[model samples]
Target chain A: MNVTIIGTGNVGQYLIRFFSKIENINLQICGRNSNVLHQFAVECECATVDSIKKIDTNADFTLLAVSDNAYKEVIEQMPNVKGIVIHTAGSVPLAVFGAKFNRCGVMYPLQTFSATRKSDFKNIPFCVEASDTDTLNKIHKLSKKLSKDVRFMNSEQRKVIHLAAVFACNFTNHMYSVAAKILESQHIPFAVFQALITETAKKACEMNPVLAQTGPAMRNDQSTIKSHLEILESNADLQKLYSFVSESIANFKKQEDIND
Target chain B: MNVTIIGTGNVGQYLIRFFSKIENINLQICGRNSNVLHQFAVECECATVDSIKKIDTNADFTLLAVSDNAYKEVIEQMPNVKGIVIHTAGSVPLAVFGAKFNRCGVMYPLQTFSATRKSDFKNIPFCVEASDTDTLNKIHKLSKKLSKDVRFMNSEQRKVIHLAAVFACNFTNHMYSVAAKILESQHIPFAVFQALITETAKKACEMNPVLAQTGPAMRNDQSTIKSHLEILESNADLQKLYSFVSESIANFKKQEDIND
Candidate 1:
């Protein structure tokens, strides 16, 4: 399989490394920055190109790992290819290719990536969607080389999952940031909450998160809730967020109870 | 050290187990429910008392592990104790002990406890506060037996930390619950998000969560945000929460940028 990955960003770099490991795979890295592309090419021992138009038309797959906002410009710069083209974005739809490309798909990896840490794709779910069955199967085969958990999802499902990922990964990180700020004000090291945070995430993953929920809000302890709101009075934004989320939790519990 | 636990709830049971393991510690279980107290006493091999009045005055510490709302009623029923009397609640201030007890303290274990899982105290932080140094030290020694991360916190500091904990632990868990609901609505398995949730938490603990933030909100990707809001239109509560939290993230970024 000849796979060409465009964009030299985090996702692009990740795919370069992953694709380079598979047997009988000819991996290529594409980017406008020649220096970084050269550096990554040397690091991954893959071919590097400065333009997507220079990519071989015969390549089995061309994966555009660029930012969503740049998709249109990048797609316009691409040369018509006979092989499948896919974008590695969660929220982007396959139709983003429009009539510009005949064979197109999406291979959105559902995981958080950080430059400081190495990501293992063994358990990461790759959400694959293609314009046709054959293209889908080809993308699935390619995704299987990187991860075992790959699913065929439509654009709507993928979009919803992306939104869910925002809550699970991004919003959750914001909660941590808020906690860090609150602790900083009290001269308390954020380290104290590390164990609790890790444990809470583990529990949520292993069990039904709604059922595993705990804390004052879950108990609907008006006294503790009031106390927490008072503590956040200095920061109106946090206070608003704290009160709103608490109410959501209480209402969610009620909704669940009614469902049961 | 003689320790009497005055409740049969989760926190009380955890203390009963921890205290039972220490050498030279005489353990006693005191609760209004005789049947539950008797069973716990048998299981823990400790003395059982149907009333706090029957508790020995010479007991080194009496740990009240009841809910915050029950603190007043429970403390009202307490017999005068020469040893330290402490409650294991986070938001409750030390002043709640009042003038009835000469030696009153607090040992708030900052962690989420669920009946389905076993909790390890090796890394859990114990926030200790007291009326005097003597009581504080006594409680610190007991806390050290269970966890290495013990700190002397004032009532105000402890209250702030408790509020921070609600964000880090409770609010974070609520994020997972929301994500789970979103996935459920789309017929997507929640299992797909496990790796992302776990990785997000580990990164937040190891680095500054604000710096570690990613996703459409962090990027201010208006297109992705708009699409998500459209998908969430059916649920007004989640839609409001989604918009509010995203705005908070953007504002938090702006605030941090100013600080820098």
Candidate 2:
């Protein structure tokens, strides 16, 4: 298979690393940044293109891995293609390609990615959606080259999954930063809470997440909640979040009681 | 070393399991219910005490692993100890033991525990605190038996850590439940997001959490945020939460821009 990946960002670079390892695929990497593109090409051992226009016109597929904002412009500017076109965006929909391309799809990897961090895609879920059956299957088979878990969803469903990823992956990660900030202010090591964070994620996955919930917030311990709020006295944003999340947990616990 | 554990709850039972493996520790497990206590005794091969009164007075240390609410009453009721009397509640202050027990401390394992699920404590952080130096050292050394990362903090510091734990562990787990609930309503498997959750946790620990952050919220993409809010329109609580957390993230991103 001849595959051209546009955008040498984290998702694009990682895909280069992944497809480079595959024996049969001929992969070409493209991005505007010549230095970054050259580095990725050398590192991942894939062909590099200075512009999307230079991408192989006869390639079997085009993996659009640019920023969400760049997708529309990139789709508009890139040379028209007959091969399968797939995007590696979370929230962006497949319809963005519209009738412009005969074959197009979405190939969203629901995990946090950064240009510097090397991530394992083996168990990561690839959300695949396409304009038609042939394109969907092509994207699916190709996605299997990188990930074990692949699920087919339409535009609406992928958006929902992306929203959930925001909460599960993005928001959950920000909570770690929040905790780290709190600890840093106190001159405590960020690691003092690392085990707890790891355990919380593991336990939620192991059991029903609601049942796995614990802490003063879940129990509605007003005194502890008040204490926590007091600690966040200077940060109005944190105080608000602490109150809202605690109230939500308490409300859920109450609803569970009524159901019981 | 003789150790008596007061409470047969998840933390207590897990402590029983952890301590059972160590050869030199003579362990006694106690709780209100005989069936449960006897069951733990039979399963873990530890001595069972029907009440705190039945625990041997000569024990080197006593672990109070009961719920936060029960700490005050349980501490008052437990037999006076010459050795350190430690409670496992995170938010509860070490000052709670002052004037009550000559030797008292805290052995808070910073992880969520459920009675049914067994957890490995080898890497979990134990936030140890005590009323006095001798008790602190004793608790610190004992904490090593259960976990490698043993941190010493004062009552105020531990309370702050506990507060931080509520954000890092409790609030983060709640986010998983929230994401799962959204996906569950859409007939999508919660397992789809499991890899993302695991990666988020692992990545946050590996790098500076704030720097590791990603997603639409972090980007302040109003369009994506609006789209997500539209999907969550019917659920007011979720809508409120989604809006608040996103706003907080956007605010943080704005602050980061200023800093940069």
Candidate 3:
């Protein structure tokens, strides 16, 4: 299978790394800069082009791994191709490809990526959606080569998944950032909390997170909650977050109790 | 060196398990029920007492691992001795041990514990505080036996650490619970998100979490944010939480930009 990837961003480069490793797949990359694209091509040991218009249309799949905001512009610029066009965005819908492309789909990898960090896609779930079953099957089969888990989800379901990820990945990370700030204020290194944070994530994943919940909020310990709030008094934003989240936890527990 | 544990809850039992493994420590455990204490003593391979009053005061340290609510009553009922008194709670002050005990300190391990979970103390940070240097050194030495990382933090500092942990561990776990709930509503198993959640935590811990932040809020992608809020509209509590956290993330990014 000949796969062409547009947008030499983190996600595109990430796919290139894995797709290149697969023996049967011939991959080419597209970037906005020729000199940088040439250098990246040498580094990745793959073919590269400077523009999406210059990309080979004979490819099995042309993955637009660009930012969601650039989706329409990139699609409009790409050459008309016989192969399926896919996007690697979490939020963008398949119909964004428009009537210009006959075969279009989405193959959103549900994981965060960075240039310096090593990401193993073996266990990562790839959410695949297509306009047709044939396109879906092809993408699912290709996704399986990179990961063990691949699920077919429409644009609506994928949108929910992406939203859930903001809570699971983004907001959860913000909590760590907040905690690090608190520890930093005390002249303590955030490293000390690493083990506990790691274990907390581990336990939540291993069990039903609702059942795995703990702390003053779960216990409804007014004294501890009061002390925590007082500690946050100087930072109104965090103080507000602490109160809102604590009350939500209490309310969740109350609802559970009533249901029981 | 004799150490008597005056509670058999998860934290107490956790200490008992590790303490019994150390060769120099002679550990005795106490419980409210005689039969339970006897069985626990047999399992831990240590001495047991049904009452804190009957606890061997000749011990070098008496650890009151009771909950914060039970601290006052537990201390009031205990008979005095020369051995330093210690409590293993985060928010509770060293003064809570009070004027009754001449030598007192705290040995609060900063981690969540459950009865069934296997907690490794090797890397868990133990936050220790004391009224006197002598008691501090003794508790610090004992704490080192269980964990490689032990720090001397006074009551005020310890309170802040506990408050920080509420965000790092408790509030973070709540975010996972909310995410799980969102996925469950879509009939998608929460297991699919395990890899992303794990990596989110790993990245935050390995790097500055503020720098590690990603997604719509960090990008200030209002369209994505609007869609997420729309999806969450049915659940007023979650919608409120989503909006609040998203705004906080944006505010946090703005603060970071100013600092830079």
Candidate 4:
């Protein structure tokens, strides 16, 4: 099967590298930047193009792995393909394809990607959606080749998952950033929290995150809360965040007791 | 060296199991709950005492792993120990030791523990503090046996680290709980985002958490943000948290650009 992956950003590059490794697959990679695309092509040993128009329509799977904003421009001028087309976005709906293409779907790989590190997609969950059984089955058969966990989700469900990804991955990452800054100010090495962060994620996955909760806020330890707030007093945003999250934890704990 | 552990909570239990495995160390376990104490004693093969008063002063180290509120009450009547005294609380200050003991220190292990799983202390960060070098060195030497990352932190710095733990561990887990709830409401399996959560945490630790930040909030994609808010419109607390964190991320991104 011929698979064309568009864009050269993290997700696009990741798809290119991942699909290149699979058996019985022909890969074509395209991006707006020729220099980077050329570099990536040599690095991943795949075909590269400057425009989607250059992509042969004979490809079995065309995956648009571009940025959310660029999706419109790319899709607007995107030539209709005889093959199944898909976008690898968490938030972007499959409807963006509209009637422009007979067979289009979403095959979003539900994981964060970065060019710096190699992503192992074998165990990653792929949230796949399409307009019909034929397109979805094609996406499913293709998705199963890459990931062990593949699910069919509607647009709203995918968006919900995306929002949750924001809270779980993106926002939680920001929380880590806040913590790093707090330690950085005191000259504490970021290494101190590495094991804690890993273990916290592990515990959350093992059980319900609500049950895995710990620390001062969950315990309603006012003195600790006061101490933390005092330390964060200078930063208005952090101070606000710390207070709001603590209150939420306390509230959750209370509800937990009532439920018990 | 003889060690006495006061309490049977998760931290205390973890310490009991961990320290029991070390060579050339004697363990004494105490707690108010006899049944739990008996269970732990049988489980860990240590002497169990119902009162802190029953613990002898001959121990080389005595660790109070009780809750924060109970620390004062337990310590007020805690027999003066010839051993180094320490508490495992993240927020509680070492000053609580006062003149009550000559070698009082803090040995706050910077991780969340649960009774369900065995905690590996080999990589966990142990934040140590003491009134003098002799005590500090003794604690540090002892800490090195269990963990490679032994840190000499003052009461204030330890508290700061503990506060950051709240954000990085407790708050991050809460975010996962929110994500799970969101997925549950939409009839989607929580497993869909497990890889994303794990990858996000891994990325956060590999580099600066600020640089690892992603998602709609980081992008300042107002459209995506608005859609998320609409979905969370009913939960006032969640809505508030969503906006507060998104705004914080956007503001941080702005500051990052300025720094660049």
Number of the top TM-score candidate:
4
Model 1 DockQ, alpha carbons vs. true complex: 0.85
Compose the digit string of candidate 2's lDDT tens values, residues A1-260: 89898988878878888888888888898888999977877777788888878889889988889888788999988898768888988788888987898988999888888877888899988888888888888889998988988888888888888888888988898888889989888899887777788888888888888889888888777888888899899999999999999998888788778988
Q: Please, what are the lDDT tens digits per residue for candidate 1 over residues B1-260? A: 78888887767777887788889989988877777777777877899988778888888888999888889888988878888899998888888888999989999999888756777887889989989988888889889999999988888998998888889988999999999999999888899998899889999989999899998888889988999999999999999999999999999999989999
Query: Top DockQ: which candidate number?
Result: 1
Measured against the true two-chain complex, the DockQ scores of the candidates, in the order shown, are 0.85, 0.81, 0.82, 0.84
Clash list (residue pairs), candidate 2? none
Give the alpha-carbon lDDT of every model.
0.89, 0.85, 0.89, 0.88
How well does candidate 2 score on lDDT at residue B203?
90
**Which of the two, 2 or 4, has more TM-score?**
4
* Candidate 3's TM-score on the B chain: 0.95
* Fnat of each prediction, in sequence: 0.87, 0.85, 0.78, 0.85
Interface RMSD for model 3 amounts to 0.8
Superposed on the true chain A, the predicted chain A of model 1 yields a TM-score of 0.95
Better of 1 and 4 by TM-score: 4
Kindly list the per-residue Cα lDDT of model 3 for residues A137-184, writing each as its tens digit.
Answer: 889988999999898888988988999999999999999999999989
Off by over 4 Å in 4: none
- How many angstroms is residue A203 displaced in model 1 relative to the true structure, after the best TM-score fit? 0.9
Model 3 alpha-carbon miss at residue A55, Å = 1.5
lDDT of 4 by residue, A17-136 (tens): 888889878788878988888887787788878888899788998999888767888998888789988999988888888789888999988888877889799989898999889899
Name the runs in model 1 displaced over 4 angstroms: B32-39
